[model samples]
Each structure stands twice: as C-alpha cells, then as structure tokens.
Target: MRYSKATDYALHTMMFLAAATPRTTIGVQQLAERQHVSPTYLSKILTKLVKAGMIESTTGVNGGYRLKRDWENISFLDIIHAIEGSASLFDCSLDHGPECLIQRVVTAAEEKMETYLREQKLADLAKELNLMH
Candidate 1:
C-alpha cells in the first residue's frame, strides 16, 4: 500500500520537529526548503500535525512550530493516522461481504503493519538526530 506524498513529508517534518531543542520552533519555510516543496504546501501538513497534538504552532516575530511535551510518546502510526485518517489502502469492491478471503488476508497484513508502526516511536529516531547535532 502506498501512502501519499503528504504523509511522507509529514513524517520527515515531524522527525525534524522531534529532534529540535525544547521550546524551539522551526518555520514552515525552513521545513519546506529541505523537501524542496513550497511553504504553503508544508503549512497544510503542519496544520494537520498541530491538530493531531504532535506539535504546537506559535504566532509572532518568532512564530513557527515546535514539538509538544508528549512528542516522545508519539508513534509512527500516530503520525501516519494524523495525515491519512486511518483509511485502508485496499478495499474489496465485490459483494463477498466480510467473509471474503481476500479481505481477511488484507486485514491481517494491515494489522501486522499497524503493530510494527505503533511500536516505533518518533523519539527513537529523534534521539539519534540529537546526538549527531
């Protein structure tokens, strides 16, 4: 299952946010520059992250975005769900209903993926980034 570009961008952006120092904010322009995307596009992704409670947005001369206090507890699944809304990548369009074997197989795979994602915390990578900086 393929995720959208927005999800990819959000994940990378979040890692950067997670790596940042406490209370320090990164502007959308700067965040977008790394991905070679426009600031306006990244702003929408930031808004989703803010609404998901993974980050906070500030307004003023130093206005930007920063990770929340509980960012260390946020998992990859959390960030993905924030951008993708928990929708399944594949859906059986036939009339087989819930008893479809294909559906069962797909569901099982999705569950396995979800478990792996849920176990991986964003803080894990951020800690490494912090050490390197």
Candidate 2:
C-alpha cells in the first residue's frame, strides 16, 4: 500500500522537471542538493527513470538529465511505475483459483487507484505550483 522513498524522490524529481520545463539538462548533483539527498543515491533512481523513457541522461561536462516527453502527457502513474514497476502491489502467495473473492476485491481497488493516477497529469500540478510561486 505504501511506496518507497525511491518513488517519492522520483515523483518530486519529475515534478521539478515538469515545472521548470527546461530545455537544458539539469545536473544530478544540483538535483540531489535541492532534495538534500546524496547524488550517488539519486543517480540510481534516475537511471530507472531514464530506462522508462520518462527522462534522458546527457553526457559530458554540461551533461545531466531532462524530460524526454511533453510534461502535459506525463502522468503520476508513469513516474510511479518508472520507480515502482507495474507489478501488482498485492499478490496472493497462496494457490487460489481465479474465483478468489479477496483477489478480485483487491484487484478492483488497485485498478481504481491506477485509473485515478493515470488521469492525473503532473503538468497540471506543476502549473498550479507555478501560480503559487
């Protein structure tokens, strides 16, 4: 039911990228400093995001990370899946048939949450943040 700090960091990092809507790259050290986290630790998480195609990593002295897609198309679920994977949060270890009522209930709940997240675009929130600042 709970997501890891990695997911938390990824969501925040994504929000930052979406809000800034920067064309230039943002250094990992700068991102880490802003979050008060270790650059090394954040790099690992960023790698997952890169693999997910949500962001790109640039190389060289001015190299860093930047959003690869339009922020308006990015959803909360996308960033969450990049860090948490799309695997079902609840898996019944016991050998239960497809008729398992508990499994059905949990699956329905998960689907509802997923739908909400999928529809909630990060760009909308970022725009609101911009207004606040």
TM-score of 2: 0.93
Least well predicted 10-residue stretch by lDDT in candidate 2: 15-24
RMSD of 2: 1.2
lDDT value, residue 100 of candidate 2: 86
Mind giving the per-residue lDDT tens digits that candidate 2 earns over 5-91?
999999999888877764658999989998999999999999998998888999999999998856578899999998998999888
What TM-score goes with each of the models? 0.93, 0.93
Steric clash pairs (candidate 2): none
lDDT (tens digit, per residue) of candidate 1 on 49-124 = 9999989999988899999987888999999999999988678999587799999899899999999999999989
Cα error, candidate 2, residue 75 (Å): 0.9
**Which portions of model 2 show Cα errors greater than 4 Å?**
none
Best by lDDT: 1
